[model samples]
Target: EWLETLPQDQLKCLVDEVGKSGKATRTVKLPTGDEEECTFLPEHVTNEKKKEKQTTTTFMPGVVEPSFGIDRILFATLEHAYYARPKDTTSEDKQTRGVLAFSPNIAPYKMTILPQDQRITRDEKYVDMMRKIRQRVSALGHSCTVDDSNATLGKRYARNDELGIPFACTVDFDSLSDNCVTLRERDTMVQIRLSVDEVSTLLHDLCWGRQKWDAVLKKYGQSSQ
Candidate 1:
């Protein structure tokens, strides 16, 4: 019966090997309780017994749960990115500033264009330059905003920090004449001056991790606040 279970070629080889062994036919009772005459191979029976003993059953404890919602994920990301800046003792205003220090790629606005002062905010040339810079940043596929509010420069920066803007580009009287702007990083507050033409590509590289903040600082030299 065991020989019959094998392929024709394998059965033929086994029959020849058994014939050489001079093993006599023996009557064995199958699971059906009927007697069958067959050549008994002790090795085959041992291997079958080993296979039966090796079989195993596994039981799963519980079902898999559904994934979290978008709102929940956003809440967790906001919680992770949020932080509070320590109050500067030297400054006249001594209030702690809350900042959402999100990375450039994840921040809602990669860059915020800010006018240096209220007067500059009102200047047609300054406003025009700021608008052009904003357009350039947007053209490179980065989200940007223009904050031409009447608030003080410090207060405006604080508000943008709270909104999780990764970088800020300030347009001043010098920018109008020199065609250069100050780029400020959120977490470090380090500023660098670069040409308006370079702003879009530089911001794109920063957001996509092609270039880093330290590299920019090293190359451009930090600008005075």
Candidate 2:
């Protein structure tokens, strides 16, 4: 009885292919506890004469969901960017320096400004300069941060590399006297000095791919890791 009351159109749709082959079996158990064999044939398929007059036609095709796994993509990206290097210390314990070599567009922050010493950052004058530099980068719609943490300058640079920061600018006592700062490439650990006024513009261009690090090396002397 339950099967008899079921929507015939939907049930027929389910077995349309089976009807064409005539090789499928369907068992129906009635409410009275008796079993019966049933053949499902949609009106369109069962009656050859009705095809010319049928108003509604449907196509059965499989569809797939299109949402790609973003988390997996991110994981793969980080894995590809993973880098390791030798330790700076003499103990011979392999100091694995892990770095994320993310493209500028994908990085969390475009650049990081660090004072060579946290002690310099404590001075009001250097703090103000760092603030202005940050403001300049922010005005260009690029994100940047200041790491005034107590970690050694080398350690801070290493930490930012792991986080995939593309560039780092260091403020030292010479920046106060010469109005310039040292810029370091995260992956290469190459250093170049540029005037504070021109640094932000250069950084914006570099991050946007308008300028390349090779140009900096050509213009300024190089420093190694």
Candidate 3:
């Protein structure tokens, strides 16, 4: 009833945010599956003074309401990013893999750290790095977990790859020695190795699609080697 009291700009921002969040609040259905209006009913007018103060005492027909579930948005992301014969896909100068491409704000982790030598190193270094990355992600209102259960680094990367984990940091023996790791973009088979401190921000940008592999490689010293 008092919604009109809200400032017009604030109302617009809210409507925009809600729309971007994939809310389908367009058509409201009645009891018989008929579309209903969102008309607001005003307080009844009793006294002559109240009636005199009122502009319209009755409820006027309103716009139709469109309401839907959050699941629809989730599915849309997966479907949009999903790829069949990924090598054949071409988008944004990158091959589309089975990525969820979720809005960065909701990823389980801004980045996932994977170690290439899972079998050779017994995944000790990779798992440890993943644990640290997971902690960092959680501290920042995100989450992460490792898939170091005797699977190939490729397999592990593929699993979380589809979960839309935007970035995966691959650690190797040299990574342990130099305190650095390689970053893999989920959508593209692009890989760039860098130091651990670089992982946090790299993850953030990848999740948001703000930074692409091409950009990361450039920032981290791209080489044709």
Candidate 4:
């Protein structure tokens, strides 16, 4: 009866093999749900006495096995996030740049703090302001980093862009006076001016998808880069 559970072609093959060998070994489930290998003999080949001595078994039904490939998922995510920006002919440097355009939720760092110029990066006031901003952002449960290198502002932005940082806050000399910083978005390269306290809250809303960039642009207007 268990042999009848197999498909037609498989049953025919099994019958051919069993006809020659007089018996075939198969794994079957017992009444207690345990499985064991048992020798099966054809009905015609076994007498009534042999059939009475044999035990009954059942075959398991087909099942679906789900699998997850981590490596493939990572590769696909990288491919989706990666793209090359065209070279800027207007600038002195005309080299194409690679950028990882990961979403705010998926990016390793939600935002990066940048100094407008190398000079301000060394200033005590700018450093203190940057430190405070970083703290505020961290308090909101978002990951952030500061770039105080001597590299130009454009180079620093490009570096963070490659790192897939979704937002940037630039502290310039004016920030020392007004306590406001320039907030820049990665994908659209849009800049907006906002106060230090406002920036932290805005970054939180943006990262959490509570606010949209277009709505922000309409409210504050875009700042000149």
1 or 2, greater by TM-score: 1
Query: Model 2: per-residue lDDT, tens digit, 1-225?
Result: 544465877556546665667544467777788888866545423423243655887999988866778888998998998878667687665667899999987798999999988789779999999999999999999999899999999889989998899999999988889998989998778999888998789988888898889887798878442
lDDT of 1: 0.85
lDDT of 4: 0.86
State the lDDT of candidate 1 residue by residue for 104-205, as single tens digits. Answer: 998879999988888997678888888888888888888999888989888999999999999999988788778999999999998999999999999999
Query: Which parts of model 3 have CA positions greater than 4 angstroms off?
Result: 1-67, 87-97, 103-106, 119-127, 208-212, 221-225
Clashes of 2: 0
Model 3, CA-based lDDT: 0.61
lDDT of 4 by residue, 48-146 (tens): 223356678999999675586778898899899999898777888877788999999788899999988789967888898899999999999999999
Q: Which candidate number has the best lDDT? A: 4
Candidate lDDT values, in order:
0.85, 0.83, 0.61, 0.86
* Candidate 4: Cα lDDT at 73: 91
Off by over 4 Å in 1: 1-67
TM-score ranking, high to low: 1, 4, 2, 3
For each candidate, what TM-score against the reference?
A: 0.69, 0.68, 0.55, 0.68
Candidate 4 wrongly placed segments (more than 4 Å): 1-67, 90-92
Model 1 clash tally, residue pairs: 0
Instruction: Give candidate 2 misplaced runs (Cα > 4 Å).
Output: 1-64, 88-93, 223-225
Q: Candidate 3's residue-wise lDDT over 99-217, tens digit each?
A: 57655566656566565654634665556666776676666555565555667776687778777776666767776678877777666557776877767766766666787667777
- Residue 2, candidate 3: C-alpha displacement in angstroms: 57
